[model samples]
Target: MHAEGADAADDARAALLAATGAATLDDAVIIARGRPRLDGGEPAGPVWKVRSTRGLDQEVSRLAKSRGVSKSQILREAAAAYVEAS
Candidate 1:
């Protein structure tokens, strides 16, 4: 059972790395951790919570890293664009 669980975890990790196009397991782990929040200063607005699927979250992480921006920034832009389109 333990070996099976370990194998499952390994498979999941591999899938995540592949989906995110990370070069290695360590890269995948770093992507999963995400960038640290900036210190000090109040937020511009009220905080809001968002939930997403694992696949979507991974893709967002990759996009944010490639663009040198925070995940929140990406989500905010996307939301603003959606509202504008609507």
Candidate 2:
């Protein structure tokens, strides 16, 4: 490989390692319970994508299962609670 090619390869390796450190997908979930990281896009939040699935997983699913309410009910309750608290 040319000198430029070698440098590009090194840069790519470093980027991959950075991405790995940024997000680790295990058991279909991205763990983001710590400090936020700003990357090439919008600021990363506590929202962890369900990598094992094709679409987003609503938090209400787990909240509902745990709280004995439907997903919609959980969302409504959460919105109300947030509005009241704020």
Which candidate's TM-score is highest? Answer: 1
How many clashes (backbone N, Cα, C below 3 Å) per candidate? 0, 0
RMSD of each: 8.7, 13.4
Clashing pairs in 2: none
Cα deviation at 85, candidate 1, in Å, is 0.1
Sequence-dependent TM-score of model 2: 0.31
The whole-model lDDT of each prediction reads: 0.78, 0.50
Model 1 lowest lDDT segment of ten? 35-44
Q: Estimate TM-scores for all models.
A: 0.51, 0.31
Worst 10 residues of 2 by lDDT: 27-36
Which regions of candidate 1 deviate over 4 angstroms? 1-43
